[model samples]
Target: MDSSGWFMWALLSAVFAAMTAIFAKLGLEGVDSDFATLVRTAVILIMLAAIVLVLGKWRNPLQLGGRTWFFLVLSALATGASWLCYFRALQLGEASKVAPVDKLSLLLVAVFAFVFLGERPGAWSWFGIALVGAGVFILGLKR
Candidate 1:
């Protein structure tokens, strides 16, 4: 099986995301969710900065155009909001159920890509999204 590098990276990301929810849930015990998110964000920022430095990928910040800055800033703001809400949800809910609900973003992203980016996914992709939706609904039930 020849797996693309992008697929491998995405797989790793999913694994890390799963671990993140469990670890965060445990760590958030008796802690403020907002404070936990701040600490997590700070660690991520420092780690990413270290990677940029180590890889010598630094470039002139001024080189980025306004359009780039606009989208990147918006993405950053969205990410921060999502994290805040997610952490708060995790603080109040069970990780097992919360994580599946959070993963509903995958289906939402697919639909958003089709609508906003003009990237169309075919039948199988739609089936996958439906399956994801069903899975989320199943996990959400208090059985």
Candidate 2:
């Protein structure tokens, strides 16, 4: 596998996402989930803003087209909603169960991409989605 590639970054994302569930779950102890989510979002905002400032990506936003702005804003809203729901879920349930069901977004994304973006998954992609769904059902669906 290439060390410096998109796949590597995506793998890192998965690792970090797993860590996020554990860390957030731990943080939710004796705290309101919504308040925790607010604090987390604030920290993320600050960190991301710092990174963008340091990297001089401030100009990047100005360069975005209207479509890019629209989509990104929509994505931001969706992400916020997801985080809120996820934190609430994590607070109320076990991370092992919550994370997998949360990840069913992957399966939904495949279907959504096909319908909305005209991005059809090939046979293996479909197979992988099915496999992941089944795995999640087995591992995360049971109480």
| Candidate topping lDDT | 1
lDDT of all predictions: 0.95, 0.93
Where is model 2 poorest over a 10-residue stretch in terms of lDDT? 134-143
The residue pairs in collision within model 1 are none
lDDT of 2 by residue, 86-129 (tens): 99999999898899989989999999999999997899999999
After superposition, candidate 1 runs with Cα above 4 Å error: 1-4
Per-residue lDDT of candidate 1, residues 56-125 (tens digit) = 9989989999999999999999999999999999999999889999999999999899999999999998
| TM-score of each prediction | 0.95, 0.90
After TM-score superposition, the amount by which residue 43's alpha carbon in candidate 1 deviates from its true location, in angstroms, is 0.8
* Overall local distance difference test of candidate 1: 0.95
